[model samples]
Target chain A: AQKVTQAQTEISVVEKEDVTLDCVYETRDTTYYLFWYKQPPSGELVFLIRRNSFDEQNEISGRYSWNFQKSTSSFNFTITASQVVDSAVYFCALSQWGAQKLVFGQGTRLTINP
Target chain B: EAGVTQFPSHSVIEKGQTVTLRCDPISGHDNLYWYRRVMGKEIKFLLHFVKESKQDESGMPNNRFLAERTGGTYSTLKVQPAELEDSGVYFCASSQVGVSSYEQYFGPGTRLTVT
Candidate 1:
């Protein structure tokens, strides 16, 4: 069985502040993939990033960055200088290689107050 | 190109009522998928379609749900006699073949409210 756990249920921060959302996963498979998605108030899910198990290198894209630590079985996302438009429900998901389904976490609701 | 699109952005129905949700994948994508998220719960996979064939449907909750994709184009999921527990947001996604990235384009989702 595969599972993704996002401990933070909700977080609020003022505009221009940085926020980090935690994600932990459990999987027996030796090879797997991890992903992060953002769901805004419109209810559409936007794919953010995808990381493979073999590559534990940290990734950064503009104001968004991700830390992948195979040692901790954790994939954390950080948003620098978050704006009001960045407020959304962030999800952490896992999938085994060639697997048909994606296992998702409970998600973290982020609110950025301007 | 347009992304995945789902019909009836929102639906409200009583218990034992029937409802149908539709999804139109990208113009040339061959992989289609369905997922749902109940209130306060994690999103779950319902099924997957490779072209017009059902690749996997192990996550479908029960027999009351039926899905079909004709001519390997649009897909439909019909829930006969929906129950309270079936109330949730249904999401549709699609991916192109040979895309090993496992990245899927998602739809806006259809919110179903069962009374």
Candidate 2:
């Protein structure tokens, strides 16, 4: 069984500030995929990023970045200069290779104050 | 391309009542999935279908939930004798292929409120 853990329940940050959400996953499979999704107030989930087990390289997309570490089984997401619109519930998910199921963490609610 | 769409954005029903939620996947999508999120809980997988055939349903909570996809098109999920614990937002997603990564598109979800 694959399990994802997100320790941060809620986080607050002022506009233009940076915030990092921590996520740890446990899986016996040697190869798996990691994903990040954001659910805004509208209740629609927006796909953020996807990383496979073989790729440990950190990724950056404009203000959004992700750090993937296989040793720690941690995949962290960071928002640099986050704006008010970035306030949403972020979830970290894991899926094994060739598996259609996605195991999601509890999610972390990020609130950006203007 | 239009994204996946779900019917009856919200449904309110009493216990033991039967409610059916509909999902129309993206045009040409071969894989469709059903997931639900209970209040204060993470979204959980209910089932997966490759066209009209059910590929996996291990995540289904009970037999009260019946899902079907006819003619390899749209799908329907019917809950019989709905319980209070069944109240939550049910989401439908579609992907072109099961092996494709990060290609699943989700619908707005149908909010089921069991009274």
After superposing the true interface residues, what Cα RMSD does each candidate give? 1.3, 1.5
User: lDDT tens digits, residues A1-114, model 2?
Assistant: 899999999999999999999999999999999999998987767788889899999999999999999999999999999999999999999987887778889999999999
| Per-residue C-alpha lDDT of model 1 across residues B5-98, encoded as one tens digit per residue | 9998999999999999999998888899999999989999999999999999999999999999999999999999899999999999998877
Give one digit per residue, the lDDT tens place, for model 2 in B30-72: 8999999999898898999999999889899999999999999
C-alpha positional error of residue B47 in candidate 1 after TM-score superposition, expressed in Å: 0.4
Q: CA lDDT of each candidate?
A: 0.94, 0.92
Q: Report the alpha-carbon TM-score of model 2 versus the true structure.
A: 0.97
Model 1 stretches astray by more than 4 angstroms: none
lDDT for residue B47 in candidate 1, whole number 0-100: 95
DockQ (Cα-based) for each candidate: 0.80, 0.64
Clashing residue pairs in candidate 2 are: none
